[model samples]
Target: MISKLNLENILFLDIETVPETAHYSDLDPTKQALWDAKSRYQRKEEYSAEEFYDRAGIWAEFGKIVCISVGYIKMEGEVRQFRVTSFYGDEVKILNDFKTLLNTHYQEQKYLLCAHNGKEFDFPYIARRMIIHHIELPNKLDLFGKKPWEVPHLDTLELWKFGDYKTYTSLKLLTNVLGIPSPKDDIDGSEVYDVYYKTKEIERIVVYCEKDTIAVAQIFLRLRGDQLLQEHEIIHV
Candidate 1:
């Protein structure tokens, strides 16, 4: 199925998010209560709401995107090359820049957005944040009345599932099994909050995000039984 689609038409991407505030105490009393109630089921007796606050970034309501890195394949002198770029900093600006990129370059039926576990996490999270910022939904991301078949989003995780809904696979694990370079070499998702709030090194996070985006593209190529890209073939813009 992947071989039937044009790889050049797909926009491969990934996003990094952090808690809206550095600490749980930073939220107002009402919001603190809401976070506790919202996360009670997942936390249970294992940890207090404050203890689990580090994970707030997983929930769109309590998080903001710090970086959204995207990549695509192009041809250069009969050789396939991959190019990547990132939008970082303020959540609103990051989202706005991503939306503009989508509208400007990929606003066609043939263009598809691809990411790892994107259907459940990256895709919905971006849309919710855009709504919170009062930004109009980009054509590719908006799925209001579209039929299920019309959604132009591709998920590497879903493709790997192959109709087995009970199993779960992390991108790191899949990439490892497929022999793609590890994207988690610098930092894993668990430490993103600390890296953002305490260290204030967003550039580091953006680099990590771009690595994941590149890995997603490479994994897709592996799935299609194609050659993995050589390091020299990757261009960071």
Candidate 2:
């Protein structure tokens, strides 16, 4: 099925998120209580809500997107390139800009969005965050009544799962096992909060996110029996 798809029709992406505020105390009393309740099962008795606050970025209600890096295969004058770019800074603007891109360029059924664990994380996270800001859902992200196979989205992790539903694989693990370059050499999801909240290094996170996006595209190519993208072919636009 993948062989029938055009590589240029797919927009590969990854997102970086952080808690809405720098600290737990930064939340209002109502949100603080909500956080405590929402994370009850995950934290259990091992960690308090405040202690688990760093992980709030994993949930859309308690988090905001900081960076959304996207890459797509493009052709220019007989040259093929995987051009990558990022939308960072304000959350609302980040989302609106991405929506514009989808609505303008990738609205067709032929264009699919791909990410590692995207169906589980990146895709839904973006949709939820858009809804939080009252942004209208683009055709690609709006999955209201679409059938499972009708949804024009792809997940490398889901592909990697094949028929096994119980196992989970991180992007780092997949890239390593597949002989692709590691995107986690600098920072990972766990340290994103500290990097954004403490150091204010958004560009650093943007680079990390773009690497993951490229890695997603590479994984798809590999799964389809194509060559891994060379460094010279990856362009940061």
Q: Against the true structure, what is each candidate's TM-score?
A: 0.99, 0.98
**In model 1, what are the clashing residue pairs, if there are any?**
none
Residue-level lDDT tens digits of model 2 in 198-230: 998998999999999999999999999988889
- Top TM-score prediction, candidate number: 1
What is the Cα-based TM-score of model 1?
Answer: 0.99
Pick by lDDT: which candidate is best? Answer: 1
Candidate 2's error at 12, in angstroms? 0.2
Clashing pairs in 2: none
1-237: candidate 1 lDDT, tens digit per residue? 899999899999999998999999999999999999999999999999999999999999999999999999998668888999999999999999999999999999999999999999999999999999999999998999999999999999999999989988998999999999999999999989989999999889999999999999999999999999899999999
